[model samples]
Target chain A: MKLVAVTSCPTGIAHTYMAAEALSEAAKAAGHELEVETQGSAGLDRLDPATIAAADAVIFAADVEVRERDRFDGKPTVVAKVKDGINRPAELIERAVAAAAEAPAASTPAAAVPAAGVSPATKAEEGASWAGRLRGWLMTGVSYMIPFVAAGGILIALAFLIGGPEIASKVNGGTFDGHTYKGVSDLTLILNQFGVAGVMFKIGATSFSMLVPILAGFIAYAMADRPGLVPGVVAGLLASAVGAGFLGGLIGGLLAGAIVLQLVRLDVPRAIAGVMPVVIIPLVSTLVVGFVMLVVVGKPIASATNGMTGWLNGLGDSNKILLGLIVGAMMAFDLGGPVNKVAYTFGLASLSAGNLNIMAAVMAAGMTPPIALALATVVRPKLFNDAERKAGEAAWLLGASFITEGAIPFAAADPVRVIPSMMAGSAVTGALSMAFDATSRAPHGGIWVVGLIGHPLLYLVAILAGIGVSAASVVALKSRRILVPSGDAVAAAAPSSRGVVAA
Target chain B: MSQIITPDLVDLDLPGTDRVAATRALAERLVAAGRVTDLDGFLADVAAREAQMPTGLEGGIGIPHARSAHVSEPSLAFGRCAAGVDFGAEDGPAHLVFLIAAPDGEGAEHMKILASLARRLIHASFKDGLNQAADPAAAATFITQEIAA
Candidate 1:
């Protein structure tokens, strides 16, 4: 017997390929010639029209909607879940073969056979996988969030550039001449007002703020496959409502995903499959996740966030330097991963609450690593390879403009040494800025872009000092040769294409 | 079944021909080989079906086919080209061509054959082997062995 099959999963990942492999192996064992095509993240592969022409039967093992079904107008096709392809591939194949064999000889003309559109239930079931649904939601949400982060960060930068010291005194609770303070204070007020433009902005920002939860929700959806989306969204919303924030959202997503997987095993009718994703799973999972967030998870996280904020506000005098060091290290440690984002978020929240010094320390530490690393590669060329030297030139511009991603290539190439070195440099800069009572009215931008920094000259001095130390340390520590040789260098060093190298 | 398989039905440069041209060329070959009675009717059948939707299969392959009133019997033409031709695929370029010809009233056998071929072509090694076969005889031998297994 000969058979043809198509395999696909919602997330476009593991299960699709696994099912294809299982079916191929089973057919081979059964003395049947089998050909299986996988629809994955990278797209389709290995398609031959001749094989399709000769197959005795067709099988579709999928969680997502399969396109181009009209091509199989006359063939008997067995549509089953990818799981069936994995656990009972031979059985599925045999059934398809039997059906094809038993069908009456076509009395009707082939050209007259009607093309079949996919059933609505099948369409719904195809998209029911939690991952597919959540991803659709997250893609929508992330598209909305980018504007908030950019606008908020830039407006704050502009306020400082125009108003400067007088506004700083007002936010710090120092009494300036009311008239002078009012001039600066008015601009801050105007900027703050845009933070809530209208009901639409409010809703959009609220959705955007739930970004992490959305990511978690989609990941869970991917795992549980269909019937996971509803629960995942419910869990995400619950996490948001209860202040479990992103962590709660992650838990909710996972919980929803697991529950849906269990539900799918019940072998419900194909008609109900579509409804399970949009209505049933969400309703059940939301109730469970929401209850947990409200009763068990919400209070502790809210209290912890408050307690941390209070401690941060009270950090003064003798403890100021220590606080700065910690904040600085946290900001640079992950370079924009969760820990770094958390530190940056804290600084922005503090700015909203009128605490400018913490933001100052953050800005100082955030800009140090890239600037220092860029300087290091320039001052000591032998410490890096040719690629690093070229990358250093670009990093210099990004570093000077205060884009922390400037150091990413270096860190990615050698995280062990580069990351630790950056953390140390940033921490020292932050601690020193705090100790010197450095202040910034704005959130970010490099030292040379003084409009964004308070006490611009002092900030420049501190930045330069940090860069000097980091560059010297890198020169001392980094090896005198490139770690990974350049492609050109490797080619040049090769004996010859015609000659083989002895092991 | 007075079907005929001709040399033109098995070409070396088909992987590079335009899909419409290739299909016409295939139909012409079948007509010349006396596999089908009316060439114009066969071409019309294929064009009408193609107008509804393309038959470009996934995995860098395509099956451009038509069942026509002109066709006297069901027949297949296999073509291979050193340089793959563009068949307006969603992912771009198609290298393998299988032009299927059947009587307008033929049964499910045509669909079954197309499905079987589509499934086997998913194996990268098999497609590569077929593409590299030295001649039409070698290609036919390989296909026979694959189906018989």
Candidate 2:
């Protein structure tokens, strides 16, 4: 059978490709041709109508909903969890083949039946429940906001590197009447006069200024599509103007998305309805969001933001260590999954509030997992294959750059052993960093920002210690055990000896 | 769609030591019934899929299927192994096995039957009905009727 399949996951990273690969391999083994389109972090690999027309069946192996699934209505279909596709592709394919044979001819091909465990409504509702849907919107916003954050942060880091920490104040306080310097040294005077690094700093600051609005805009866009963008951005700007931070951006995004979605659903005459999405809806929604943010909610949100930051700033040493441990474990938990995102976002919010230590601990912990895995591969070569060893070599660079996603392959392959090992290391690092009172001024630069880090030697010690623990533990655990999918669940039920019945 | 399986395609009790032997045994039955034109070609396709991933699911079921040029029509072969065949599932070996085969160029029709069979297989009652079937005819009737419904 000629088959077409789509694979996606909430994070749109490793699992998406793994499921796609599994499906294709199964299809080939079955002597059937298959094409798999992956909707992943990188973007979409679209399946054309020609492929759909020729397909005997369609398989949607996704945790997230398969976009444009209606296109497959004329084909026999099987929808299963992405993990199930990885585990039971042959069965899924057989089911699809059977459905194809039973479905009537193309004259009335509309009766394509859903396989077991999937209904059309449920498929659409994959992440449609209130909280899940909200999470999806936030993730969309985060994904879109990442580039701006990276660019702005790296530029600011560079500015600090070249012009020193005093640059921000110096650029404002120091003065030069075109030729004469006042209140600064020669280099500082000249540098401050020309504002050479200052330009880069200002541009970066400008980009940082856009972060909240962009996050808000994209979150709303994810919820109501393009119609929500204008109001969301405007509301975010209002929040920023009123001294509201990430929390305000989040609320503004939600409010704008809701308002715009409601507006989109409003009944109107044909000509006016046609114009509404392009003009009327955006205009009305933006005004509404602006009023809500500036007039009603601004002061309350600003005070809440201040209170949150103040409380974080006032945390005692023990509380700080506990907070760091929790954040660190979350960062390593899924290796850039939603839990990791929550911790990282919290760190960013803290950075905006001038608490550099939280960001420092978060980044250090985030960087530990992949680095530890890479170290483990070197320390115990027998535990990993040739391919994995090669991957470890690349992981060194990814870890140094603080891309937590570098550990995903290892975690995906052996979550049972790798994740806990990673979490252990990260928690140690986070807690130790906090205990040592290490702080980092730069939002990100990985090891390159070691110069900007407070208690640099102890910070390095904390990181190395974490690497040692994670590397040793992961190697030990993996050697003693096999990586069963959802192995933890199996382990919890070991006494019962009823694996199949648990599900 | 036409009946994809018959008594000729059913084996109430198949004795095979492993997945390969079981798969080949089922494919041979299809060949013997004139449903398959090239036995080697068809078996090769089935073996290729088994090598890719073990078809053993969580249950005691192994579904090994192929779409091959050797197949004359879309067909299903059922085998109940009293002695289990190891299909390399995480849980264990498989006792109830299904071999789905389809001829080349009949993709749509093949998938329709395959999907219906898959949907019915999810129910424990449906599996129990197949397990308790008296003979090949009874098993075939049970499978065909259940899928049709």
Candidate 3:
């Protein structure tokens, strides 16, 4: 079978080529003809009309949205991330082939291919292991949750930076029922302030508050698709209201997803099943999840959350640093995988309780991997390829925004070296942030909200120091095994590609 | 470009311990095929490109390609390293090697051919066909047919 593929990434460098290369290799090895067009920084290497016409299927492996996607409208297409293409090219190819074979013959050509809006989840999950499916769902949640966190956190931090330390109380002086602005000793009351700072503060806070619910909603959407959204969001809001925090959001999302999944599988009448997703499933699941959260598990979860926050607040400086180290390691472990989510969730869980130090540490650690990788590439240019070096240039902005996903390509390429280096750096940053008592008013925003951080200079220093450690470690680790063969002048002149050279 | 690679350029068993040696050996074949004008200059360019990123890929295939002033035309030389050549890929060394050389300033054609070769290399069966081919002529025919697809 003939197959055509397009590979792209936001950076449009490493992963794009990597995925293209992987797909091409896999297709050839499988004895199927394949052609890959790379949409990269260097620009489009478009698929020839002949190849496209002859192709039985199309594969889209991209992080950023693909341009001209409509070209494949009538073709059997397998859509996935560039990472998936690189890691599981054979599998993606197989799915594309199968999808092409399964296209219904009775329907119109346009209708025979799945609708434009159809998600790739079902098709991609056809042969996926349970663990793989779960990972996919969680990753989808995290990917969706990032935009909200980054935007909200940055805006909130801007508010604090512009409006000063007493901004929250100044903006909402009379409306607070009982929430105290911790560390604000001045207590400046600017009732109904409509200044620029005041407006910024209010808007930022509003966005910041939606963080948990959005996370839950999207997580459920990932699990059971659209039907799980309403219930998951309602459960998340309840979790926030009852002080269950991120953990509650996770539980709520999972519960909503599971409920929706089961509800959709029920042996209902044809007419009922048609309306199930849009009407019955959503309404029933929302009501059920909300009822369970409020009546059954709400109080216990809230108290548990409160207890945890209380314990964290009571920790001594050394213990806080230790906790910071652990959290930092977790954040760098999988580069936005489940382990990183645990650290991020812990930070968000404590956020509502005014324990900003943990959040500060978590964000700092989260920012380390990308920043360190970028720095490593800069310090030792030959250690990485042209695409990687280009990607590193983009990592700076991504890291500053606290997008841990920026380090994914590097980690995906060489996890053993990259992950360990990142972890060490993140741990150092997390521990130092806690030890110094540097705090951020926002959960994310990285260096963009630097002005809002308590002891901003110290925080910056801690982050830089971590980057240094990680960069140095990565360079050292990489260069250690790189051996150039003697007697080959050309080999001696050229940079060694593999660190481990066979004798 | 379909005829750029030939049986004369296909070596069933090439000896090389690493990328530099392997690339040099393949570059030599392109010179013998009258595809390269200056063997040393072309080989140097290939080495420089390889240094930028090891062409060693998943499934043990190495595509060391470069556009150089030393090239007379676009060409492809195939090499099968029995002992494997280290191209620095995290996975492992490469057993199937393709040295692609194109005239300087003609990047489009070079990239097209490389892309084409990359797609074919992805299939296990295609790689197996090349690996199990009895002679250089058979391997060249297999590659030519695959690329034509």
Scored by DockQ, the top model is 3
Question: Relative to the unseen true structure, what is the C-alpha lDDT of residue A304 in candidate 1, on a scale of 0 to 100?
Answer: 63
Reference contacts reproduced by model 2: 0.02
Candidate 1 lDDT over residue span B1-149, tens digit each: 32223344677676366777777776777888887788777777777766654655445666666656676665777777556656555666667776767565525444344334434545566678778877776776676455434
Residues A1-503, candidate 2, lDDT per residue (tens digit)? 78899987654433466567667778888998899887754456578766776677889999888986756754678899876876678888888888878765432111222322222111112224454455445654554554565565556556656765344445444311112223334544544573666766666667767867886787676566557789989987886787555456767888998898788666779889767866898899999999998988776755654554455445534488898887788789866544576567677767666777888898899889878988998988777644356557656755765656567546633456788999999999998888888887765556766777899898888888888889989988977754433212211211111111100
Interface root mean square deviation per prediction: 12.0, 10.9, 5.3
Docking class of 2: incorrect
Best by TM-score: 3
Native contacts, share recovered per candidate:
0.00, 0.02, 0.09
Off-target runs (Cα >4 Å) in candidate 1 are: A1-95, A98-210, A237-248, A265-279, A329-356, A365-426, A443-449, A455-503, B1-149
Worst 10 residues of 2 chain B by lDDT: B106-115
lDDT of 1 by residue, A294-386 (tens): 677777766666666665556644487788887788667756544465566677766666677777778778877777887888787766654
Off by over 4 Å in 2: A1-136, A169-195, A269-275, A305-431, A437-455, A463-503, B1-149
| CA RMSD, predictions in order | 17.9, 18.8, 19.1
Q: For model 1, state the Cα shift of residue A236 in Å.
A: 3.7
Query: How good is the docking of model 1, by CAPRI class?
Result: incorrect
Of candidate 2 chain A, the 10-residue stretch with the lowest lDDT total is A494-503
